[model samples]
Target: MSIISMGTHLQLLIHPSRSPIPHRGSLLQVADHGVRGHRHVRAHIMAARKAIEGVSDELNAVASQNMDFAPARRRVRTAFLPVQQQLNHVLFKMAVPEIQMEERYEKSSRGVEIFWKSWRPGQGEPMKAALFFCHGYGDTCTFFFEGIAKIIAAAGYGVFAMDYPCFGLSEGLHGYIHSFDEMVDHVIEQYARIRGMEEVRGLPHFLLGQSMGGAVALKVNLKQPREWDGVVLVAPMCKIAEDVTPPALVLKALAIISNILPEAKLFPQKDLAELAFRIPQKRKMTAFNAISYSDQMRLRTAVELIKATHDIESQLEKVSSPLLILHGAADKVTDPQVSRFLYDKACSKDKTLKLYEESYHSILEGEPDDRILEVINDIILWLDSHSTLK
Candidate 1:
């Protein structure tokens, strides 16, 4: 769908209808091998970041004008269109003609219609394998992975992803994950359908996950030991990072409150875009990602995430799929050490871990161009090696 522009100083250029496109990666110019070159690139990023902040402040001001909620939201979204449009253009330019995308809604076992998207080689191209993805908390499969999926598809593998219930366009109270088991069940129910499809069957299947998704991938493997060939986790949350969790007393208080008011959105949810994205301009651009859940973490969801991570930690030895874990050395959102924990404790005979130095939570999208690309290249090489017919 296209954003309808309005009359204003910030005019969002009109474009063709948009689909599942990735972020603007091609915008960054690769720096030459010199300190001066690196500094010049950094200066450009800083300047663009300043401009993005200015626009964001203006949009926030427009939103706070005492208008009704719906109207105000519409105004804010409209104002943010230019930044969004710019990003879309970058992804569109990076489009791979060989990778065809299809979007549809699948009715979950719980009866909620979950959004699903797939990218594979265009018609007549033989598929060698499939990559099924589970996204992180407060994140959707639609936006962030748009380009990442394309990268995998370009590597001769089909990629399929679903936005969990309540996240992205899926139906539920926004930002709520009622029960982590049910969440896993939803992924299982839909994924089974994909696996049984005539086109999808017989292909080597793997699970790819990020942040909390890494835990989901692990659970999916635990639930069905023989289903997947391998699992790839990027900064997986095998356990909650110490700093992000509330104190024990506070958590007990929240648990009590959660039972009384499960929908209460009182947790001090940090602005993830700021914490996750290391590149300044990329971090600022996150403000314009209209579908991302930027609201405070609901008590119920927070409790469930904490519980899920704990459960995953205990069951690490039960993990049987070959594993590849990628993490940012300095990630504060999900401790890199927990990934180390998975590597050490898992029973899988073939498991690998790669840590990117000085990176943040969103290693796939938020890292510097070279760093992120290097990470993706690592994943691609791993998948290629794994997909070879034995």
Candidate 2:
């Protein structure tokens, strides 16, 4: 029999002398398989064993209880997901510092920083009409347009897409919430201020706002007003049904809680990362693997995205610009009702609602590239027809 010390390096004895031990597991054995990430847990156990074994193994009853802290760990994870989503929403969209997207640049304003890409046609000198793109929450606009730039540019429009503040090549900060009025009045004004070069100020301008940007475009095109050829909104998140509580609420709640407890973890993305906005018609490609990791889509701190959502029912009457609301009938993100609502309610004398039976939330960049191209051509044709008519 051997005696072991309690506080110093573990003492090893040749024989066991205990009649009964509370923590009766073997000194070198482990229960349950390893966690996916902490593959080195066994090593950690072995390393700590040299120091902790000195205490009577009975004490391990208390230590083991502390080891399997499932409830506590769960609470910790629950809190972390939201905050992480916010930071990553900006980081994942930008240059990523570690992995570079095709085209990247930084722009700053109002103590805010953003990243953008001004993709011109590779074949021609330049385009007369400009396609301004605004991305949704937690998405990089450049990535959304990745391989489709040539198709869009070929249609005689220079594509200028931007990652929202705190995303992509933009700066590092929590997501910034923008009111519809602010997006149109302030954000677009920021674009106009820098865009007002004598040579290009008078060019045909068209705004393409997707999801959150759609709401922004609607507000901007209506109030501030732009003499653009037309406005195209794809799957704008104007009105989300009550059945679905968006992550935006999590972001907002985090903003409030984080103010009080700066270090408190806000885990909104846990659910979002698991969700995917798929079109049920034939199934299309989504940017994030929603099926496998639905929470990944919720990778953004949703407060800003949430704030961008507004019911423009009364405001729709104010928009005078020609509008195009393109929505996927089977989108898992924004509902077709939104498209129906916009079409039935918009007062634009020349409003068009094109519902693609096979398209999803990412109408332009989903599974079948050819179909998206067709939509683009249809847009150009409509724009040309309207231009000729006017």
Candidate 3:
């Protein structure tokens, strides 16, 4: 994906083979033709790159000492997001003319300004249902999900997503999770208002979660078992793979330290893009997710993630909503076996699971275009079948 400034606007271009719709001719052009726009975008990219490079040395120094420099990191991320978001693989150069999209920030009950987005079918198109998304840790719904939401909305469903407090464009410390449960409550509160909108008030609603967001969806279902009509999980993080988890003693120590320094960025870091994206090109594009949380895990955030997984594991049998679980069999970040475990333990009378043979954790955004479409089509099929159920 590359950004080209055309006159006053930035245009995004995607390689032919990477285009989500294979039938659409190669070279997705997203901006009006303008040499001036190209110069503007080039300059913007250069400036953002320089700013990021300036902070590299300081970030490395802080990392070596296992100290928190989140504020500095956040500033760089904020500075680079405008350019980065334009280069997102799924979004760059993609067009969804049939879908109408809107972005806004709403004041949550807790007084935090929550950033959210919605995609609905164009005027005169009858709504089918509503799909509320729970984005993964380190992810903002405004990036890859932007293209995804449009696809679903084009299929006649209303799609909604929000950035968790502190994550993405939302207000709060970047990558700092004070309490997992409180975060869940914030999601519930915000989604409830969207669900109540007159446009979708009486429609069936489903929850779709990827990675850590999968755990969020599960918790939401558990908290209000009868609220959602179904759930779609993509490589869910029900149990953090053992290899990725810290040693027992290390986890114990981290838990102890979290009580004192909940926001400290002391946990280990890993190249998650490598583990999650199977296609080399797609993996490389992950670098453009400017607002994603790529730093070391915060002390409390790590502990809370572990605890949330454990809690979900124990309550799997209680999951009664209709479920559609899609996982990459070769996923190493989150265990594919755990997705299997979820399939077996979920008490939903209607449940389905599809495992891609050599795919990685990010089936939707990291797989071949055909595979990504396959997963998406599967989700739509399942939702279509269940949308009529009371």
Candidate 4:
């Protein structure tokens, strides 16, 4: 998440002052009513900080451990699930009362229990199109996306998102990826069902991805070129930034070790939240994402990510879906140049790229409320323009 100066919209909701937690209803009231000229918003931020701090030590301890297996990671997630849901941020607390949300667990073709979610306009609202989400590495669709999906749904689109097997509420080794291609197949399978749903059938379908998930979306489009109408990429990992990638010798060593102990949590990694979020308050809030994979990269996961990016880089010309690529020019996690490369290489004649100057990797979640809304509005406008409803 990247930082930005607090805009008027955020000033109404967050203050640097420290205070005790306010009542949950009061916090919601302030958000719903757009209340200003009070300390309630400050109280809310301080309260959230307290809540996150209360659990940080425990979560950090768990993250520091050698959680090479699914059970260990699952245990930590289960233990902190309730705490995570209660933590608040500007995005999470934003009110979108006109949208309906649903969650369920389904058995995938590979027998993994997948956790999927949907956000749609209220029953009587007009339906326009469908947007399927692909979340970034170690991130869950259930966190910051709740507010984002609701905003999109309120704009007359059906928004669908899912936790990949082994991530979030999905059943599998937590934070483990045996094969990146198989994961993409699972996403394709689940989305195929959602596309066929009665509510969204026959509507334009778009794929939206962030960071590593950007790579996943591209792979999905490559595998089923005609299935999607367009693709939206946010700071996509077409190629990992050289600053984040390990030294070539270290990468080679990790690749060799992965074959022997694929799940070992030994690969070194920097604090991504620090690098990705520009806002100090927002970066601090990342601890509230209790289920995100924050430990050392698992040996196999690292190798698979490297291989996936390489594969996508070589096949960029095959991406034929209408494309809208958005990247933060200052993003350190994923190279913005690669997004430009993708824009130049994709075969789709209808493609666009918008680069936000001074923004960081987590553009939607970390940027100021004004900037965040700008990006969301940009996306909604693009969707409206491309949809049959327009």
Tens digit of lDDT per residue, candidate 1, span 6-75? 1221111111011111222123223323321232211011011112344566665553332212234335
For each predicted model, how many residue pairs clash, with residues at least 3 apart or on different chains?
0, 22, 4, 8
- TM-score per model over all chains: 0.77, 0.60, 0.78, 0.79
In model 3, the clashing pairs are 5-37, 5-38, 6-37, 7-37
Off by over 4 Å in 3: 1-91, 241-252
- lDDT agreement of model 3 with the native: 0.71
Per-prediction RMSD in angstroms?
Answer: 14.4, 18.6, 13.6, 13.5
Q: Write the candidate numbers in order of decreasing lDDT.
A: 4, 3, 1, 2
Q: Best candidate per lDDT, number?
A: 4
Please report, as a residue range, the 10-residue window in candidate 2 with the lowest summed lDDT. Answer: 13-22
Instruction: For model 4, give the 10-residue run with minimal summed lDDT.
Output: 10-19
Query: TM-score of predicted model 4?
Result: 0.79
Q: What's the best-to-worst order under TM-score?
A: 4, 3, 1, 2
Q: In candidate 3, what residue range of length 10 has the lowest lDDT sum?
A: 39-48
lDDT tens digits, residue span 192-224, model 2: 753675534666777777766677677667655
Query: TM-score of the candidate numbered 2?
Result: 0.60
What does candidate 4's lDDT look like per residue over 185-287, in tens digits?
9999999998988888888999999877888899999999988999998888786544444456756766776666666554333345555777878777766
lDDT of each: 0.67, 0.46, 0.71, 0.72
